[model samples]
Target: MSEVPPRAATAAALLIDALRRAGVRYLFANFGSDHPAIIEALAADRERGLQAPAVVLCPHEYVALSAAHGYAAVTGEPQAVLVHTDVGTANLGGAVHNAARARVPVFVFAGLTPFTLEGELPGGRNTHINHLQDTADQHALVRQYVKWSYDIRTGRNVPQLVGRALQLATSAPAGPVYLTGAREVLAEEVPVPEVAADRWGPVARVPAPEAVVDELIADLQAARAPLVVTSYLGRTQSSVDKLVAVAERLGVPVVEYNAEVLSFPHDHALHLGDDPHPFVAAADVVLALDTDVPWIAASAQPPAGAKVYVVNEDPLQESIPLWYLPADHHVRADSGLVLDQILDRLPAGEDPRAARRAAEAAAAGRRIRAEHERAAAADMAAGRLTPATVARVIAGLVDEETIVLNEAISVAPEVWKHLPRTLPGTLYGNRGTSLGWSGGGALGIKLAAPDSTVVAIVGDGTFYFSVPSATYWIAQRYGLPVLTVVLDNGGWNATKRNLRRQYDGGAADRTDRYWVNLQQSADFPGIAAAAGQARGTTVTRFEDLEDALRAGLDDVAAGVPAVVSVRLDPISHQAEDPV
Candidate 1:
């Protein structure tokens, strides 16, 4: 047999090289038969010592995408997620919806069923399963959820397609993008394109119009009651700094409602509590900065005469088919850039009423803090293993060097109130309405900040949804040890709360069976232990909580994943219970 000259670079090889060139550091992958070409190309690259994005094998697609989401949230650098055909895409589930809603940039690609059947192509279908896996449109699985979707038709343009896909993925209002290609296309040999790296770069952040900035500042300066609301602006550290500066300069109270990140210091004098209803009702000038839903209209709304301004990268939320937020001004620009513009354009002196407003805000903040502190103390004294109690204990464990992933659902509001995240990047939450994000997100956070202590505060329901075995296995295999503290109330507390909220004396509430309850038979600590080298502990008593948490933290410090499950008091059935 003659030794044939090796064919030119395969599409998969080119794709890997393209990812490296685009500054991708990791490729979270869940493989299948559809990905043989990519698998072989990666192996060949390894043999040749060619530099490419490091591949991290994920047992599930949700974990792969959520890890990518976590990495991007911390580093502001999008990572790649590769999966199998339609089946893998389907398995991605809520992670896809979450990534899109959270505006996290994750490059997700999948292999497709082979186009050829009878050996006409180098990577034709050799198995019977390929026929069953064929889909008319694989991109349809995630098309609506993703920012953009495309299919790579040939190896000749794989690099360009990848470049375009990444450009969109990392651009303003960044979100996940989907790409797919058949096995034969991935295996086809083709020449690399001569393209400049600059061509593939993300679109530069745009500043708000000077006139709009001038008008907004004037409104703040003239208004007696001005309020600033943000959700995820703190995704960037500079944004948080600028927001703080702007709020201080204007003596405007800032409310971080349902915040996905720590937008402003909770201890700041002008920082109001998470509930924006009262503030919204009183705000004469409301600046909704980078927040999607500043105030729920169903619950409360600003005065009809008040000037409401919405500033965001995608102020219009074009992707959302039905979004209606009445705003006097809708400025479509980067929040950080607009904030810089506001800072630069503000008048030299503070307003006459600034001191008065500051005093009022500080008083309001003190009252709110006192209430939270009192609630926590009462829970401690009552020997009730409540969310507030768990949160207070967890708060003691966090520091500037720690990154907390909040996915505790019903318990998250308590976590937010008790855990005062003064630093910008120290705290993060899954804003995508996904149940199983924190485990994978913690892994990604660990990957991004290897020295920082990563902790995931998850609900018991979310723990089951997170594919704990896969996440722990990946953590153990990759040497990424993170502490996971599960706030176990033994059921879907959020679902029960919703049921009660809509129907005060609902049948489910009356029966004390919401149908959202999970089986209490499973031992979470044992599950964690069986998954990997994760040390697991169950804390049923309030006094033992601190020790258990500290032990978990110690395990994490010693380079081992830890799971500390704290069983808490279940949701109250009484109508007087806070919804």
Candidate 2:
């Protein structure tokens, strides 16, 4: 970066430098045979003391991609990921889907098989495995999920192309982008182009139009019962603040359906519980702000003639093939900016009607809280280690500053009920139905916010899906101490529950043939213990739950990754004749 003229360098080194120039700080990488050129470039850069993004070696593709997703969720800054060829891309699997659904920007690059044959070029194919790995279309694996996919043909424009990829990824309605390159091109040395900083920037927020402002204002002011619903608006702290002001000013109760972050303080008078069904049914006006599915129309819908306003960065959800939500008005702009506009246009004086609505909502909130508390108490009295009790115990162990990642699939509602998230950036959940994102997500969150306590609550099935060995290994190696609570219910409870719900009188249900059951004994604690320098423990009885959870927290506080497996009742099965 001195005044001297730039020199030629390997495409790999230049690409790394490109990421650094683009403000990428870390590269979560899982290497393979195709990455030799990249490895050599990294080594050469190190020898010359040139700056580049820090490479965090990941053993599995799922963890690598999920870690990048988690980091972006907290910081709102896309990170970089490097994986192997098609095989590694296949392994990315559901984690990439999770990233796409969450709208987290990430730069994902993979190595492609060498195009040259034996002895033909410096970085030509050298192994039989290379022949097996080559695909006619490598990007086809994830092309449907990513915003953009490209194969880098030449090294001349590597930096500029990388900048463009990142710019597209970070723009509004952000998501991951894919890039792949062969070894020969990556090893080709070329003069680094003078990078232009201004050309590859993200598009700024598009403000809401003023023409429909008066109509929206009139509807909001006239409605007797208005409601607001959101999912990921809380991803940005300022957005959460703006939403709170606007909702409180209008006395509109807010509900979070499948929320990925804590958008509103749970204790607020206008903060309704997660389910939007009951409120949506009675409301005359509804504002669906930054939510994909405001309500399942079959289960719940607004009154026949309700005034519905759909507002988001992408109100139509163009990425999704079929998004048929009802909307009277569609505002395609930044949700936070729209909230700011609404707050500014409202009258300064408080309305008597708005105050009365707030008071009624407070009563409704109290009822909901009491109902949940009673349910938890009843479960405790049943002498079982229920999800409610597990959630309550974990809730007691964490404070407002702790970063909690919830992937307790069937029992997620219980977790949400017991653990009230009061602050922004304190809680996250996967918007996608991926089973194991939270394991690596906890690591990424810790990496981004090192001072915060990170706790990940995962189901027994999700724990297995998360590739615990790889996740915990990264945690131990990187000095990221995270407390993972495994809610062991013995099997895939969500899948089994759905089966029973749909086939109550069917032969499979009558025979108690729940094929999804994982009846085998699993020592989840031992799995954690296998990771070097990590602590593992188990709790079965309700009485011992608190102590075990506290001990795990203590271990994490002392700088060791810990796993506490809390065993709930196993899935019930009818006795079968001896095989």
Per-candidate TM-scores read: 0.96, 0.97
lDDT of 1: 0.87
* Per-residue alpha-carbon lDDT of candidate 1 for residues 1-579, written as tens digits (9 for 90 to 100): 111114468888888878877889999999899888888888887777764689999999899898999999998888999998999999999999999998888899899998899999988999999998998888888989998998899888887888898899889889999999899999888866665656888899898889989989999888888899999999988788898899888889999988899999888988897989998998899999988889999988988799999999989888789898999999998888998898888878857677777888889989999999999999989888887888788888768658888899887889889877888888899888879998788899899999999888899999999999889989999999999988887788888888899987878667786766564546887887888779978898989999999999999999999999888765543333255
What's the count of clashing pairs in each model shown? 0, 0
TM-score, predicted candidate 2 vs. hidden true structure: 0.97
Kindly list the per-residue Cα lDDT of model 2 for residues 1-579, writing each as its tens digit: 441127777788778878877888899999988788788877777777764678898989899999999999999888999999999999999999999999999999999999999678778988999899999999999998999999888888998889889999999989999999999889888887788746899999886887666677778778888889999889888888888888778777899888789998877778888999999999999999889999999888999999999998888889899888878989998888887788878889988878877788788888898999999989878867888988887888788888889999888878888888888999899998888999888889999999999999999999999988899889989889999898888888887888888897788778877766675378887887796468978887888888889999999999999998988878746454478
Global local distance difference test of model 2? 0.87
| Every candidate's lDDT | 0.87, 0.87
Off by over 4 Å in 2: 2-5, 381-383, 574-579
How far residue 220's Cα lies from its native spot in candidate 1, in Å, is 0.7
